[model samples]
Target chain A: MQIELVYVPIDAAAVLSGVKAGEDGAVTVFDGIVRNNTKGRQTRYLEYSAYEDMALDQMRALGAEAIQRFGVRNVAMVHRLGHLEVGETSILIAVASAHRGVTFDACRWLIDTLKQQVPIWKKEVFVDGAVWAPGEPFPAEIALG
Target chain B: MRLEVLFFGVLRDRFGERETLAQFPGNSVADLVRYYRVIAPELGELWSSVAVAVNQQYSRASAPLQNGDQVALLPPVSGGSFRNIHAD
Candidate 1:
């Protein structure tokens, strides 16, 4: 299991390589990249920030949970922080499993869950202006009064 | 008691990265939220939806706070790419 929040670019090839094992039959990957536009507005770039310590803790727990819940052989998740240009890789997730079915399920779950739970935020810089992308509300269990 | 309060995302934009609160009278996370609301009335509605972290852990409003504890105010997180059709 590997979970990291990096300031530099995410090496997708290296992350995939690290998760693969001889025992694994399938290695599923999800590569999330920065896009150049939002709601038809041209984006110049994006700025990502995180509550580092808490984000890492949440990520580590999710990695462990993915392995046990999906019965995957290995899981590696990495998210990049700081400035990112369009088309740059923003996040990468790899799940190795004995079969392809579980690997796909695990990979999807990892990304979806991370978006909702992880303490990371992104600001989209557009030609007109910049705004913090609205996020999904926290799950009721985590949201406090 | 002095508490180190950290802010992230939009909250950081509003409150800066961190602030030191001296002689904090609040004893719990909720009290801290209430105090913030009092000071920054413009952010009154925003406070209701935020999640609190005490010492880097997810904490409830009622969780008791200690002197010198590190508290964080987190707005909703938007980490990954927005998956709307136009986003791609």
Candidate 2:
């Protein structure tokens, strides 16, 4: 399992190469990119920030859980911080397994869970103004106070 | 006790990045949160939605605090794509 929060652009080819092996039949990848607009508002750019150490810890835990829960052979997840322009990949997820079904399932679950549980945040810079993108509520158990 | 307090996202913008509270009167995470709410009453409803973390772990409001503990006040994390555009 590999998990990282990086400042530079995410290299999808390099990450995919590292995860694939001869034994794996399918390698599923989820590439999340910055879009040109959000809800019809034109986006100028985006800035992502993370509670570095804590975010990494949470991401690593997600990768481990994906492996265990889906029985995938390997998992790699990376998210980029700092400035991101439209068309730039913001986050990447790769899952390798002997079969395709579990690979796809694991990849989806990883991204969904990470978005909710991880301590990373993004600010959307729109044509009109900038606002911290409203976040999904924490899972009931995690939201204590 | 002295504790390090960190804020993130919207909270960071409102309260800066981090502050050191020396001789903090709080005994638990809830107490520290209440103290912040009193000083920045303008925050109002935002305080009730924040989640607390102690030493990088998700902590309960009743979690006890000690000297040198690192506490974080986290707004709901905005990791995925944008949803509601009109939010302040």
Candidate 3:
């Protein structure tokens, strides 16, 4: 189980190396890079923030869940905080398993659930202006609003 | 109870304070939100849309509060919506 939240620029090769193993037949990675545009607007950069303590705990839970639900050998997740320039990797997830099917499923599930349950937030900086990226509504069960 | 209310994302920008320590006159998270809304009406209706996190977990409005509890107001999260990125 490997889960991390960092402020430094993400190194893709370094992340990939963590999951590379001789016994594992397949490794699936999800590289969440910052794009240059959003909804046709030219974006300059992005800023990510999180409630650090809780965010890390939630991420660890997600990694554990992926291991159990998908039968993956190991899971690694890293999300960068603070300012991020366009094309920089903002988040990365690497999942290793004996087969390709579970690796893909766990990798996808990790990212999707991270967006939903984790406390991290992102703000989009546009060329002309800036706005906090509109996020999906919380599930009715946990929503306070 | 003295509670520290935390703001993140747009809420931080709106409140103009990253975190504020205040005496919450009520006992639950809902009371705290209502109490602060009066003091800072500038937050307006946006106050109602935020999700509350008690000590880092997504908490319901009626969740009871204790002195020194760290309550965070969270806006919507857009982290995984990166276009041209490998999410799926």
Candidate 4:
């Protein structure tokens, strides 16, 4: 299994490769997109910036962990960067395994772990000309939720 | 030795995109935080939510610092788009 960190359109990669299901095999894919709203406000677009080194290291580590934890082989991941309009694909993950169970399990772990650990910052630029970025303000209740 | 650390996102806006030279004492991430606390007290309140990277790699805030390493300050993240199911 291999993992890649890049700044590109996530949708292109997600559908670029189609994994074939071997006899008794299965494949699982997941795609994360830019949504139209956050909390209750409308969003215009998203800008992602990365702490490249740390983000790659963490991604690689997560890939290794996924392979070891679930007997999943043949994993691919791609993340987008720069400015993206709403409803655009931002991240994509694909996995192929002999069975469906392990594949789904591995795919889930990769997505959840990446969201929590990656240094990617998604700054929501709203229609009203306001931008809400990480490492910025929000009430304690807002920050946690 | 002082390693130039670049700022990004909110940190960049708050501290500016300019690099900051911080002297290393080879301490844990916590120690570095403390050092920065003394060096740039304005950042103290925002420390907990911030993340750090050394030479382009994400590291634990508890990780020890090394000389000549390029450190970066990272904020939070969000994104995940699964493409397909188990196959091949």
Q: Which digits, one per residue and each the tens of the lDDT, describe model 2 over residues A26-145? A: 999999989898778899999999999999999988899999999999999999999999999999999999999999999999888888879998999999999888777888878884
Q: After superposition, how far is residue A84 of candidate 1 from its true place, in Å?
A: 0.5
- For every candidate, C-alpha RMSD to the true structure in Å: 2.1, 1.7, 3.0, 6.9
Give the per-residue lDDT digits (tens) of candidate 1, residues A1-145. Answer: 8899898999888998999989999999999999888767898999999999899999999999999999998999999999999999889999999899999999999998898889999988899989877677888888984
DockQ of 3: 0.49
lDDT of 2 by residue, B16-73 (tens): 9999999998799999999989988997877887898899999989999999999999
Model 1 residue B85 lDDT score: 27
Task: Give the TM-score of each candidate.
Answer: 0.95, 0.95, 0.91, 0.77
Query: RMSD in Å for candidate 3, one decimal?
Result: 3.0
Give DockQ for candidates 1 onward, in order: 0.57, 0.60, 0.49, 0.27
Who is ahead in DockQ, 1 or 3?
1
The most accurate candidate by DockQ is: 2
Give native contacts recovered, as a fraction, per prediction: 0.66, 0.62, 0.62, 0.37
Worst 10 residues of 4 chain A by lDDT: A136-145
1 against 3, candidate with superior lDDT? 1
Show model 2 residue runs off by greater than 4 Å: B82-88
On residues B3-81, what C-alpha lDDT tens digit does candidate 3 reach at each position?
A: 8788887877867545656655789989877876887788675676678898888889889999889888887665654
- Report how far residue B53 has shifted in candidate 3, in Å: 1.1
Candidate 2: lDDT of B57?
96
Question: For candidate 1, what is the DockQ?
Answer: 0.57
